[model samples]
Target: MSALPASRDDASPLSARAGLRVALPIVVLIAAIVAWDLVVRLNQIPPYVLPGPLLVASTLIQDWPVLFGSLLTTLWTTLEGFVAAAVGGIALALLFNQSRLLEYSLFPYAVVLQVTPVIAIAPLLLIYLPQETAVIVCAWIVAFFPVLSNTTLGLNSVDRNLTGLFRLYGASRWQTLLRLKLPAALPYILGGLRIAGGLSLIGAVVAEIAAGSAGAGSGLAYRIAESGYRLNIPRMFAALLLLSTAGIVIYLLLALLSHLLLRRWHESALGKDN
Candidate 1:
């Protein structure tokens, strides 16, 4: 009889664990897909109006070559823009960190660039610049601000006690920045990178939309627009799915990188079990 209550207690936690481990997520995912499929099928939605997952998958397989090629192009453009933003933004942040006068003088301009809608400026950029250059520039502009802003904040937010200690130790300005400030700011920098990665993808797509087709350098966004123009709804949805997947992958990658880099020392990186 005593063993019965003990077994029940043990079984309760195991049952809850099993639900969390397997049942809950599977149920939620199935429910979502079922609801989506039902809404599409039961509502008599035309494929053009809202292609079902099956139709989208069929489209993906059928147009694999075209869709994959466009995916590669968009990925390349996003990476290029993100790389440029990382280098330029970090440099600018460092410069601003070193000079309050310059920060005050130039920050408003950065804010203006950040606040200005890429859609508004993309057309002008396309008109004024070569096609490939315009797309890259527009993407760079869209992604640059987050890294700049986050890194600057991080650099400025070094612990006051640590700063005082470093100063007391006769650490020079450059030494303090390199040994203390930059390390302290890394988490913030990584956070900015996550934001910039998504923005880079958006910027590349938006720039392509504004620039339209110019020779063979078009990305996924161009394919999306072209597909829509030709009423290739399934293909459009397929391209959209690829874009969404890419964005998710990029975010996961950055999160993984952040965790790996910070896991040893940072509280944010610690797993809940720890």
Candidate 2:
């Protein structure tokens, strides 16, 4: 008799690969920053024109109070907009899924809103709404479509056989949706949330930039604009770096949340080659 080799369930190889992926990007980022610093120093570029990374870092520290305050304001607006988008998008998608007539009638308007450029609409919104409200609306508008479309697709993506079995059990619409449809649709919905997180930040920034520092416009975007006007290039770079870092953090957090929620059952979130 011959014995077959046994397979193990260890994921250490994939874990190492994941570790490499994270470490490699960090290394590249450090290298790039170093290169940037060297170039600015070698060329003796004026600080007003282009500041080195060290200057930017120092400026970030010196301007921490103002930057942190603005960051908090921007984060609040982002949170508001993201909450609105998530709620409205999911509610509307659910409503549309329940009724074809409503879906056909209102989906086009949603599409129109999605297609219209937020920058073009920001001025008009400013004319009508309060500055903060307009900024929030802009963020909401940009973040809304992905959630709606993805949820709609997910709700419709249920297996027909499973749906039939649910029906065979005489399951009510709500029961089927809550138990079968939503659970199946979770991955798509999480993906939409991840996309929406970044879009919401961008939308807030665009609105803030367009609005300018008129009143108490305290946001990283406004700071960037103000710094640009004053020719404080290092501060501008610092604010920009903060904005980029915020966006990346939002995306990573959302991705981690999605991975945690879906890792057990969903193929997409399962470890590579698992």
lDDT of 1 by residue, 1-274 (tens): 2323344544765456655679878899889878888999989899887888888889999999988998998898899999999988999999999998999999999999999999999989988988788888888999999999999999989999999999999999989989999999999999999999999999999998886755355588998988898888989989999999999999999999999998899889875568
187: Cα error in model 1, Å: 0.9
The Cα local distance difference test for each model comes to: 0.89, 0.92
Tens-place lDDT per residue, model 2, 70-95, is: 99999999989998999999899999
What local lDDT does model 2 show for residue 132?
Answer: 91
Q: What are the clash counts of all predictions, listed in order?
A: 0, 0
Candidate 2 TM-score versus the reference: 0.93
Give the Å error, residue 65, model 2: 0.3
Where does candidate 1 have its weakest 10-residue lDDT segment?
1-10
